[model samples]
Target: MKNLSLTPFFILLCLSFVKAQEVDISGKWTGNSYFLGTQIFTEYELHQEGNSVIGFGTTKNGSDSSKFRLVGEIKGQKIFLKGVEYVYKVGKGCLSKAEFTYSNSGSMATINGRWKGTMELTTCPPGVAGRVDLFHKKELMVAEPVAQSGTSPQMLQSIHKDDFEGTELVNALADRKYYALIIAVEDYNSPDIQDLDNPAHDAVSLSKTLNEHYTFEKENTLLLHNPNRSEIITAFDELASKVKERDNLLIFYAGHGIWDERLQQGFWLPSDATLDSKAQWLSNSTIRDYVGGIDSKHTLLITDACFSGSIFKERAVFNNSKAILEMYKLPSRRAMTSGALKTVPDKSVFIQYLNKNLARNTHPLLSAEQLFQSFKVAVINNSPNGQVPQYGPIGQVGDEGGDFIFLKRGSR
Candidate 1:
């Protein structure tokens, strides 16, 4: 007996039968897919015109969820779809290539195929393949649109100004000042506390960028190099006292950080911190308390140290509305970190992209979320060890779904 289970000519055979039926693959498509022998749920809203097919989809594998933009072409009775971009992802996600064969039994229409992932797109999972079994949801009313607006809300969450709807939202911060507290701990007094090469230099670079390009003035931006635990708290206290309720505050930290798994806490090591004890280490909870004490309308915390992402707890991330100005209306406590609960490099690829984006940005009122998302993908792709950057609202820190807006010097 000869085994003809499947061959490379499968796609060719599907194409021959595809011409028998007219293809109109539009509207909702929901089904199951497999990768690494594990089953995953997928939902797509597709539109097909002529031979071109375009859509967006949400896929879930257990607790992990990701939204991807789809682009494909209809081949006779078959469709070849590829994930071009990841609009949103909860964890490590990569682009996918899928080929589906559409078949109708007069009562129901189903598409079956196989999907593969791009290993280089994201780390870990390497690359794998599995089967795709999808059924079209046939609820006809001429045009079956995904949303009231043609675009999905997933795309709207993107930080680009051009992607937003309506005019810019007005920010009444003309009388207010943008205060920045930059703390970079590079030189450690204790041998136990590892010294970093880039924090001090990074602090200077960021201060210059803020003063020259953004609304933050030189006098308003305070730089602290090799600050002890006391000095760090003193800096926050000063900001709390000096900053007005309408003012905005930006806190930037770059140095060695660690997560105390036993205590379920995270800390930033000051220059004087010792390995024997966490006495001189700055606790994230303490920082959160200090951040809450500040009356600033918006607070943006940028951390470029290891395990910096631990600042957020049950967080709500950036989701841009129709107008840009809506970002600054409510008081917010937002954090932008280099990577999630992982050790980052000393030289700092995160800060490099961050500064580059800030310098090149011409937008008069750029939100902190916009700045972070613009270079997030680049940081992930360019990082040597595939570090995943994080951005979200800090818990119990007076965050009201607003964001810190970076005003360009001459744009306004």
Candidate 2:
């Protein structure tokens, strides 16, 4: 007879092995890794076989870059890897270590860990210490696709103010160009909310005005009707792709909007947004982020929807619009909302006044500040509910006492 002992150490080891086998980490992991004040795009292509894993990490910046072979093992919920970092600057390898704790909830996968090593970049001295304490996630971790409505808006055509050629003062404004993205969502997929009137019509009317009156190249004016949340985001992304640092960008939206009283946040409801499915709603903070990411010298957001005022409460720059020449020298980010966190009628008195004022004004260049102030007075006088408009510069959003000048005849 042979005597066999089942020790506690062996029991724990078996449990760890079982846990590691239950979870699969056999895919790509990507994130931004920062070291020595430089951001490095990192990607790890990993393969898991039993409890052992092997992979490679590729990092690059401009012409400086390197790749490393990674070897690691999974124990319970933790992952440990070791490698040698080959620096482009030093032309030699240095020791590196990474430890991570991973989790997956259905399709959403995330891994957070700490990495320490030596990395020498072309911008750094020699033997620069590198440390990355961050999290990586599976790519394209977007929410489930929302139902789309209407046909996809056509891509904006590139337009240039070639009228500048051979004109005397055209040389003065030659360095500047104008771009506009106008969106209107008048219908909804959700039955809980009723469809609105005048959004799509208003967007069309505004687009025509911008193109004909403001010298916005008809090709460059992008007008979208009844766009989904993703389409709205993509519209901005496309606009950003084409604009330059010296250009001015204008965005206008007219649709259903909601405000979270508990969270003190506002959201722009897309055509597919449902009361039950909150993820379909686009937050104002996200719009702010997108507006900030644009490279244009001046950006203005005009919204005619409920809770639009909430977007600027915290980020309002109180300065008045500056002189034309001085304003052109500085940057500006401003907004004019229809109303605050209250119900806004579908008739859209805000845009009505805006259209009337801009159309009738004889000013060669109507500043955004002037348009906002005029609308505030007109909306209060006309709306039975006294839905006063809100206007201000976006705080911390690169407003520098400048104004968005809408050129009436393309010359000032």
Candidate 3:
């Protein structure tokens, strides 16, 4: 040995070994998993002994359930699990053998991986194949592929102004599901009405924000651009069919709205609507009926079009903050409009202010009522045209004096 210094070499080897060692993944974790473009709420409870691990988990989608019985081994920072996911279909038990492999995300607290399975059920005819992208429950609960900004408690406090009260109750929105139908009709068949400048772009921007910040499911969000009357109705019907009582439904329309003085009602002009045919325009009452039929716990209609205030029957009275959990259980129907039965500028001051506030809102939970108040204030203060935003309950609809809850990501 020619003056071999063993210290540095020994430390390097030890560090390499430590780095390659498997992390301890033993705990309860809850997160969302995506399969076929739908978000599924998932939970895991695992117990590890030595390198071997055993666990059971449950996945929920509305009323449907998928239970898993798992056995796995942790090997060099990766976990390999083999399990049978028992799912109920047509009142019978259907089982699928699944394999999941999760690699440590440089932290023992979290892991993520892909899950694949094949089903050969007794009740069904052919075998089915399925694959899902899943992840360990992260402290910051936002959409994936986008890193969390990790706003601290101090930052949250600093951002919340005194005007918006009851922000401490924001965590109540965590368990609720958000569904949105965003419609923007910039192009129209009639040449006399003129084309819009920003509705389609605005709709897309809103949809992206909803997914990135609010955890809206990809499948549940309907982004309709320049859609005709039938298409609009079909979109609403589809959303109504899938929504559940634990969910919140948002219907946003950015287009031309006509106030029929003779009928004392408002109509949303679709892409195919012509000046000659009033029948082609979709009535607010018809839209209300479609929204009221949904099983969602809360429904909000946001319109940037002209005469948008015609959507609400009356102004909402109960704006105070109650127990958020109990508040979520109550039904609500609300609307926020750009202007009170007047023509708003096509540039969209309403959505601009609304987006800015919502993106910066630090409250753990923000109610629709609070959101509307902010919109009203901002639009009145900023807009040169003085387009007064309106907010209230949909008349004769299911307005139960309850407000819709919006969860701020990582608020908990």
Candidate 4:
């Protein structure tokens, strides 16, 4: 036989091929599966070192974070990880195993697997607690498609008055069993009010429009106009008292919003509220406290006001961040404001663009994030002076996977 030497170049080529065939199942992944009668989606960030893997899982629920360890090997095209499960709120569960088939072709590798396990509850000690059976499967794919221009005009027309049909959005929301509250306030009581003649007329007209179009199946909506501070407080208190498990609560406020530095929070400037008297105004924290006190699974807070961003300040006395973050992490609560800190609220813009646009679109449901982006763009485009609204997750966006839309037009 002819003598042949294996050169370094050939050896390196073989090593490259082996590496290419190997799948690195590291980094962050979002998994969705139906478990225990609820659709549970979790975000897992994992790190693999040598033959051991460690990671944490954040579920759709607001449970405490969970830590997971995996010890397995890659055999041919299949990878296996087996170990005990330790969830934050739910403690050490039975031993679980994960099996995945990885296919490496080009830049991406597809991982398909199933995870079956029983979880324990750490919060409830001295008791084994109920067993949690879970199943997880994943598929690799390209990024989610972006909103396209093809859907933009259709969405825009949906929000305009010319094409708007009353109650279409409201009825659609009712079909989804969404309990929504719509509040419209037009205050003409200001000392510098130039529009004195149309105060009641404006309020009545807005109320009629909302009432004529929106319908609530759960009858959970509260519509108020020019309510005094005490009235607003009482209304909210009554609503807070009625919360139940798995309930969806929505608080919609449309009014003048002011930030009092002395109090260090925002306030919905009721018609009768005066800047001079601190006692007459309701603090933003007070509203948050009321909402937070409600033991509901989800809450949507929408405020349309100038300087509405002040409500989200980090140093407010009744810092809502804790509760907001908790509820959001549970993926149950969301909040949106019309303007940013120090930004002047454009009431006309909110109604004409934001609300109207939501009433028009029929496809590609808009999300809160998407709405914020579109609203910002629309405001800048329509305004004589370019203006942009400020928005961000009160907690983390990953927690709340669902999107919000006005039911009438299915536009978010």
Candidate 5:
């Protein structure tokens, strides 16, 4: 997509800048290469003749491994290489090209670049490309797991990556387990308030979609239907206590919302909420507090309700085409609402498009902003009243401009 390159992401490596006739890219390079959203541990043994470069490297994912040859040149500050013909991977004839910018923090040289995966082979993962970040072998902080090299074939086909040990599961730039809090209130106790139809049904649909295709697991996802105010608060409290700083959190709500003009406040009506009393209603500010309190790398709140847009403080901005690695570096608190202080229908066009898009995405990493951009305009055009969906940073929620990344299953 756009002008960026794509790579099959099967093979690649790194190294130290040795002293030579030119800026040398020789020696053993060790680091991580992100391809197809999988973090492949790589090592390169390279030799340079003037500006020309030649190398062979190995990439390991979970227990899978493969070898390939590299050929490229030193072009000023960037090194360009093509990983062609997977020697051990069974694939023949393809170019997994990468352009890396060379930099040094003191004596520690680092190369980071984008990949362009050309499908010359029979099988090439299309859609989105990944990033490669390598440091000199000296910069490696921990040792990666190495199989007997015979397990590559079977490892490549396995859906689970539990074979990778230690904290590799929590690598911010790679794959990790995602936690979710799903709250949907369809049956309100108040006779004065009209009951809704899609909240519980939509929640079930979303929960299944997330657990089946994305990084979210059944154990990690908490679902509550027709929950009262206390139960809703308890769920947040439990997540705040359990979620670690490196993990990500997604909170989804499908229910009725009200905007009080006199008080300038927005509230989510719980199952126990009465029309005459505001005590049982959940305020947007309280939700904000919980969002900010959770020690997660990224927190994305998806609300399908009237006046749900009140959570947003200012418009969020991030280049969709930016490297996924770059986006994962910071922390974020963001929300995507059904509408901006406007009444939405019981049958939502918002959640409809959201589900369709999530299931259809083929890329390894899908960011929150990317997900919203895919369906916001469509929902507006298709809605009966032309409801405008809102997306932005949640106010005072410690948003450091990071985005919530949805890692599709089997990517790692």
Candidate 6:
């Protein structure tokens, strides 16, 4: 019958039916492993060399010296490994094992089986093979993908800054008038402070940077070094009065923050001030009240300090107090702090992210929400122990509208 061409046709069909599988397990993998129903987690990096795979795994205790190797062959859709060795450390003694497995899928394989092995003790004896399910995914080659386009012109103009020139981001956002007031307080005069050599800490250099990098409206930007409590109060009072007539306002503060349990409040310590004596000099409530009193439709308060929660309580009290009612009624306000209320300020990292991402535009562009999200991610990523940076709207005055851009086209 078709013997004249059957062999060639069959061979061609088989070759055409062979499909290549895609493997993508690369970089770092974080997952938990179970041994005898007890779970242990591993964050490992897998590297593939020809037909063999090798990598090191790190446990929660920060131990990562253990090495593992797997040698396998891929035949069509099946994979087979003859010798697989894993060596690791436990409480005292070291554990080592060699096993073999027949896998069904090369690209994606899961093995669920029992293993019986011998323990290395003085009287070594065979141990029961506990159940194990090892899951393997093919390694993938990865590269940083390009950012998507179609962003607004304002977003496109955002600058990128490291810690050294972070003030630029605030200026960039402020140029668009997205921010109403930008106040930076660096304590360069403190006797105990030693890092003042940084240009960021110098009042003159910082002010010059702000002036050259940003276009500020008259009386909108203030860069002070070790100002007294009275100066801060006066500035807030003046800024509040001016912003009460506008539709939106943005306020930013960077300095040392201290929490006093006795007063049940937090205070921003100026350069010349001490937490031991001036606990009441510049209370968080004072600033909150001033910002809360603005008649603007939207108000954003960004503070890089500790005990920021104390500001909300003060804002609430200020809204209900008679002091603010004489000049202006309270408006919607949103607040964000760089760290927990009792935590220390992450000044360099916080301001660096703000300056780098907020400044690329000549016009007001980024919404307060978007900027805060980016800042939060950056801070958390750079922080130790993966500590989460906390942020949320503080009081009832913040719910009128959700979107507030720091820069807008018109004068307030």
Best candidate, lDDT: 1
- How much is the lDDT of residue 77 in candidate 2? 87
- Which stretches in model 1 have alpha-carbon errors above 4 Å? 1-171, 315-322
Candidate 6 lDDT over residue span 1-412, tens digit each: 6896798898877775554233323334454434466554534444444445444444343343333333444443333332234433334222323232424375554444333445554211466334434566443434434556964323223223222112222332342332245555564345653322232353343334334444444455665545667777776777656653334666666666777888787787666665346733577666666766666556767776656556663332122212211111233467766666556434456656666555443533445556566667777788653434454455544444344455432211
Better of 2 and 5 by TM-score: 5
Candidates sorted on TM-score, descending: 5, 3, 1, 2, 4, 6
| lDDT for each residue of candidate 3 in 1-412, tens digit (9 for 90 to 100) | 5446887898999987786565665655677666668777767666677788776666777877655556778777677765544312223233434445555655535556655544444222334334544545533333324445884333443223221123323422455578899999999888878999999988988887777666577887889989999999888878778887767999899999999999999999999999988878999899889878988889988899999888877533335666654465568888888888788899988999888777777666677777777767778888878888887788888877787777666654
RMSD of each: 18.6, 24.4, 13.3, 11.6, 16.7, 20.9
Off by over 4 Å in 5: 1-175, 315-321
- Clash pairs, model 2 backbone: 315-395
Candidate with top TM-score is 5
Off by over 4 Å in 2: 1-171, 315-321, 410-412
Candidate 4, residue 303: lDDT: 70
What lDDT is reached at residue 227 by model 5?
97
TM-score for every candidate vs. truth?
0.59, 0.58, 0.60, 0.49, 0.62, 0.45
Q: lDDT per residue, candidate 4, 1-412, as tens digits?
A: 2334557667888987787456565555565534346545555445555545555444554452344434566665666665444423343233355666766556444555655543434122232222222222233343434567666332222333222122223322343434555555565465743222333333344344334443334355566767777788887777667765335565676766677677567777776766567676677777667656665555667676656766553312121233211222244445666566554434346445655544443432234455555566686677554444554434432224333343332232
Looking at model 2, residue 189 earns an lDDT score of 93
Worst 10 residues of 2 by lDDT: 159-168
TM-score of predicted model 6? 0.45
Best of the two (3, 5) by TM-score? 5
Candidates in order have lDDT scores of 0.80, 0.73, 0.73, 0.51, 0.77, 0.49
TM-score of 2: 0.58
Across 1-412, the per-residue lDDT of candidate 1 in tens digits comes to 1345565467777876665556778767899887767788988777777789877777898779887778899877779998887655777556778889988787777889988766655422434778889898975333333666566532111223232221222223444699999999999998766677889999999999999877788889999999999999999989989997778899999999999999988899998899889889899999999999998888999999999989999534555552455566677998999988889999889999999999888666688888888999999999998998899889987898888887776432
